[model samples]
Target: MKSTLRSELYKALTNKMLYIAIAIGLAFWAMDVMENQEKIKFFDETLQWAVNSGLPIGTGHEGYSLFFLWSGLAPQTKGANLFYTVWPVFAAMAYGWSYSDERRSGVYNQIAARTSAMRYYISKYIAVFVSGGLAVAVPVLLGLLANAMFVPYAQVVQGLGAVTNINFLSELYYTAPWAYGLIWCGVTFLCGGTAACLCFVVGTSLRYSVMVILTPYAMFVAIDALTNSLRASILKNVRLILSPLRLVWSSPGWANPEWWVFLMLALLTIFSFGIGYWQVVKHELA
Candidate 1:
């Protein structure tokens, strides 16, 4: 078990696709930051002008904070949209297709000679989390770091858009901005891992690597299509059930994304792991 787990971890970490996915994610982050450059400059100029004019700056008056500058939390720019919109691609792109590839290449059978198939599958399942989570989370972390250097570390002020926009974790945003950032980082990791595993499950059932890679994104779009129609309706209460894409987003596009909606993804992760285990170990499908 330990050897299989170690082998899986090594493969996951060393996959060229993992770095490719990370680079793609960073590209999205870079575009987001670039598109928001004008806003950043405006805020910077505003703060400088206020300081130069001897204007009393307080709370709502000042805007150069980590929250406002960070690519994920910035206001009004859909710059992060490109990143968040295709996050599933980033998630699964890292290593989700490994199972499908290995199975197709006869590597699974080769490895099965030394270890139980169950252990191999389980180790790959666990390895998926490390690669997928890092692929998605690292870009956000880097964005936070870049923004932190760009601006002074100011707590999210009540009057700012950043504070007001925090719908799910408002308390942490108010009290500990650091915690807010960390929690979001954790959320992104979990979501990415779950998404990758969903694709991993698809790989168990399907032959094509592309199909496995796109399974999560396809399902996400399908769900979004259904829920978006509800947004057109007058039932404000219904909007609380955001699609997985919006659920993972820091700032939900429409109605408030409840923390409870994330449970669906948790359920999905367990289901995929369960079904994959059943197919490979019990049924010997793979």
Candidate 2:
């Protein structure tokens, strides 16, 4: 299993798609930051109010500022919400080609002969998960770092109040911004990795790289549209589960989700992996 994992990792590293995924993620982040600069500046200007209210302005506030910046920028326009609209596509592209590329290059047959189908499938799944997660996480982390460098750090106070979302306004973000950032990044990783695996499942049978890669993004859009059209609060909340952006941002009202939300994400990933594994095992490599 270890050897298989290493071999799969090597293949993922060498694949140009991995780099392309990272590049796309970064490009979206760059565009989001540029588009949202005014919001960041406005937040900075509000620091005087915080100062008047006896708030501390220092490095401790950097994380909170960045968190606030992200929250504000993320929901302003659909285009700014890269976590939902763009990350999944990049993630799908990152691993969508895994099986098809291997099949076309004849590596699938060679690897299949040397290992059990289950082991090969599992190894590739792990590789895809890691590669996809990093592709999404790295760009967001870079954006966070940039915020720390450019945005003024101002402590949270009653006057400045909290960001609308509990996740950003929570004590966790105020007292320990780095840890908060880590948690957000972790959620991003899970969303991206799971999205990639779901694409892989489609790729196993679809055979077309473009369809495999774009399917996840299309599904997200459909869900978003459906949820928007729904009038019931319960259905809207349920649909939030399907939204990677909401999951990561911990959007207003749904912020500080119950443990079941995380469990749902885990189960979804496992279910996708199980389906992909089953399909690959039953597939004819001829």
Candidate 3:
């Protein structure tokens, strides 16, 4: 297992696709920052006005608050939408080709001769999850760091009262800003890793690199559309479970930090891995 993991890790580190994923993430952050420059400027102006008027800067709009440094880069935010939309693709690039490339190059036969299918699959799974997670997390963290350089590092107090609609996770945003930011990064990593693994699993059969890579993104869009259509129904919870946006954004009516949300995510990850393992074991390596 160690050898397999090391080999997989070496491949991941050397993969040009990994660099492409990172580039995509950084590009999204850059675009988002550029688009939200007006908002940042307004925030600076508001702070200046507060100082001139002898009023506390905390009285300004929530949009200008320090919390925006992190929240502004969330998947649901306008500037960050590009990142959210293409994350699955980034994830797909991270691991979708792990098996397909091997199969195509006849490397799987050599690896199969040395290790059990289960060990090989498990190693690839871990590598895919870790690499994919990093691919998604790093760029968002960079964006947050960039945003923080411009915004004041103030507490998110003034924004609390405005949140008349409660999201169970809202307290963290106000009382524990760091944790809130970490949670967003964590979710991005988890979702990105899962998407990559799912694509890799699909690639076990499909073998078509493009189709495998796009599968996760297509599923994400389909789920988003379906959930939006069912917004008024009780199935909204289902929508939340399926939508990565829910993990990043504090929706008006939904109860976030809900145990069920994590539970659902965990189950999805396990199910994807389980299916991938089964596929690998049954597959006839060429």
Query: What are the models' TM-scores?
Result: 0.86, 0.80, 0.85
Off by over 4 Å in 1: 35-37, 47-61, 74-79, 162-166, 233-236, 253-262
All candidates in order of lDDT, best leading: 1, 3, 2
**Candidate 3 ranges beyond 4 A from true positions:** 46-63, 72-77, 158-169, 233-241, 244-253, 284-286
Clashing pairs in 1: none
Q: Give the Cα RMSD of candidate 2.
A: 4.5
Per-residue lDDT for 151 in model 2? 57
**Per-model CA lDDT versus the true structure:** 0.75, 0.66, 0.69
Candidate 1 C-alpha lDDT tens digits along 1-286 = 9989998999899989999988987777776666556666777788789888999974342365667556554334464677878888888989999988888888988897788888898899999987888988898787666556555577666766444442667667768878888888888888888888887566556777878889888988898887787678865566364677666666564444445646666787888898788778876644
Per model, state how many residue pairs clash.
0, 0, 0
What would the per-residue lDDT of candidate 2 be over residues 1-286, giving only the tens digit for each residue? Answer: 8899999989876788888888876776666666556556665568667777788874244434555556432444333565455667777787656776676678888888888777888898988888777777777777667556665555545335343344433566656656767777777787778777777556445666788888767776776577656626656455234454455554444444546457756876887787776677876553
As for candidate 2, its clashing pairs are: none
Tens-place lDDT digits, model 3, residues 1-286 = 8999999988876789888898988888887666556677876787788889998655554555556545433443565877776778888787666777776777877887799777888888888887887787788777877766666566665444333224535667677776777776777677678777776556556657888788777877787788767775857454234565445444423444556556756876887787777677876552
Which candidate number would show the highest TM-score if scored against the true structure?
1
